[model samples]
Target chain A: MNVPLDPKTLVAEMSPVSTSEHIAAMKKALLKNIQRSAYVYRVDCGGCNGCEIEIFSSITPVFDAERFGIKVVASPRHADILLFTGAVTRAMRMPGLRAYEAAPDPKIVVSYGACGCTGGIFHDLYCVWGGTDNIVPVDVYIPGCPPTPAATIHGFAVALGLLEQKLKAETHVEAAGETAALPHPDIPYALRVRLEREARRMAGYRQGRDIAEEFMALLEGRAHTPGSFTLLECMMEAIAEERDPRRAEIIGHLAEVVQQAIRGEAPRGETP
Target chain B: MLKLLKEIFRTGEATVKYPFAPMPVCKDFRGKPEHKAEDCIACAACTVACPANAIGMETDTAAGSRTWSIDYGRCVFCGRCEESCPTSAIRLSDDFELAVGSKADLTRKAVFTLADCACCGKPFAPAKEVDYVARLLSQSARSAEEADRLRLTASTCPACKRAQDVHHIADMGIARQMTQELETTP
Candidate 1:
């Protein structure tokens, strides 16, 4: 899985320039072609802006990918690569598809994070419409609720390998590290807890008709008696099982209670 | 091609010898905020100006406005705090080197000593700023009274200081800034 950029035997891009006089002019053109070939455009369908922020940090001073001639362009039409973030919301689906189509042939699409990859944990929601692969051909799928700048670069390194076949790179140049660029001496405990919680929610598979029926049933229910609640309330309550643990530990507690209840242990009471 | 290969081999390493030697980041880059407590008059202006609610004045009711806290964790580093400080008390510095193990650790705080006003004999601004201004206006005994009377703060009742917001001062002492004439020569 190690792919490296080897500039050796670089396709003699100038057709071997028949005469010695044209050699100097030919060399300049080849170098220009090498630099012109790398262009990436980032697209956010409806992301919460976490992945976008991380992606922005990547191009900054610390991870400066411009060193490798990779540049971030604004327009999708002029791009050679599509770096997509967010779960494909219903509104942005068509525009996202059009953007992918507009990026000319021989373009690479990188699914930027867990949200873009499998709809992440927000898939069960009503607003989210599709995962990344539904609309475009995704070449690389980065895993994480909002993949770090390092993870984004790691995915990019993989994409470069697929774009150009090559042997091992001599120096093991790893992707960007945030510790050096970040001001703080340590990753805040709050952020760590938040990211870890997101990791747990994106665990289940999709169910088409059955899921819709259950969801509609939840919407269509009304129970006024004791020990009974509306379907939406029940669904909202059930969301604990599917909730991304980053913000609150409430759903995680419910899931833990359910697992404990099934295991025949007396469920612990909620925090006051 | 052979010459290009030789050039590549001869090129120095790209990686910076960081930790041991840090790379110089661009000036004006928002990394971290540095506060100068000496200049800060404890106005709570930075707190009110901060859009993110990341900066605020934390104080006990009895102690009055004691400490100013800037939550770097929530701060967008918008520079609004620095921009709004009338005394230029808060200034953004090049030192962006901030990292924390906990969110609470990111909050920067400053506190000042309290002092009573020269005229009203009431608790007004911080001891040092009040003393410094008192010393400066000693020449014009009336200006010291003007400064003390006009020493407005959140504690100052707005109703009483309504006219004295410089209009009264202009009529009594300093002249008001000129209004533009209809036909002005540039």
Candidate 2:
């Protein structure tokens, strides 16, 4: 019983199941007015289980996903919504497809977590298909490393039509004569670099940049009115106002560095 | 039964009023990466720093434009892009609701014009980046001549800069030294 198999047919065979017009219309109706409880079946293709933990947490007492009539079911047979929670791996492709097929028609497919949406950090891996949409048509995409319980709830809300999706695709084109303005035109570039380097060395990049910006603002204020107040006096005032001891110490250190720069002396803590 | 009812009442409702009311997020909550395109120099720092390859850039030399794009669906909310940004063009905002109905809706893009090389007519880097660097160097420059030199250096392409370096080295009579070494070799 040898049947001749066409190469083109084999290639086309791997494509995702196409929805019929009846099923599409039914899905539209389901999305429009889904009054009953939506049973969700989580399909873990090849995840690290971080998304699973978040999903369970969303169902917990504090988050209470059941309050919205959303329940996690054991089998796809009982599911009205399929929650795909991993980057679709080569090994799990058949299983993922099986779960999708097991679920009833007009079922909503949700691409959950960063992995499920677009494979997250593992997008370029050899075995991965990059996203759930590669294997199944996704009705909703909930992106996060592993979304928080609240974020998960919001995603469910969007999926169920209870809430609207906030993010819209945006494209910004450079207009004629549009230019990025200099951050601090008044401050010397060298001094700004030194100050930013010192601040970043003390605090982390995020906090360091913030502290550097604040210190530069203070320096600029003093520079604007040299006769009004001394730079040291202004620094002392800033230090006094700061509640955090560590931050105050960093600010003091930055002030000393500024003072050394002003006096034409090499930076204090570095080897000459 | 009364004690149970009293206990339930005392506990209160544990569910959050999300979707209906605004949810309060903690300080430094890494949710959605917001890009202030106006401040961005199109340096591709975020694209390089992004762990998920969510941030990407495409340069069309023919079009004389560079397009910067981010697929939120692929972003892991790691904050690496925010950290690596020199001008604070990109930062993680508190907005977390990123669910989308369409795949295309999950992407955001920005287009920037490319600057032509001072030596060659070909487009090289982003205009904003070259302008920003030129301005930064000029700010630190000691004299007007030095500022002009810095501006020229910033605007020139790498190939032309290399060519200039080679020409300068050639003018230094390095070939004479090479011949001298060859004659002196035992």
Q: What pairs collide in candidate 2?
A: none
Would candidate 1 be rated incorrect, acceptable, medium or high by CAPRI criteria? incorrect
TM-score of 2: 0.92
Highest TM-score scorer: 2
lDDT (Cα, tens digit) per residue for candidate 2, span A1-272: 24355677442235666778899899989988888999999999999999999999999987889988899999999999999988988889889999999999989999999999988888989878878988888899999989888889989998888888888889999887777889888987768888998999999887899999998988887788748687888999999999999999999999998888888787756665
Error of 2 at A87 (Å): 0.5
Error of 2 at A138 (Å): 1.2
Ten contiguous residues with the weakest lDDT in model 2 chain A: A9-18
Q: Candidate 1, chain A: TM-score? A: 0.47
Question: Model 2 misses residue B53 by how many Å?
Answer: 0.8
For model 2, the stretches where C-alpha displacement exceeds 4 angstroms are A1-13, A225-227, A268-272, B1-4, B174-186
lDDT string for model 1 (A1-272, tens) is 23344478432221110223354354334334544556889889888898888888777766666655568998988887788888888788778877877876567677776577656556556766535765665756664445545445555655664222111112111122201111111323232223223333332111222232233343334332356664336645657555445322444443343344345564334222
CAPRI band of model 2?
medium
Q: Return the top candidate by DockQ.
A: 2
Relative to the true structure, how large is the alpha-carbon lDDT of every model?
0.54, 0.90
Q: Tell me the lDDT of model 2 at A149.
A: 85
Which TM-score value belongs to model 1? 0.36
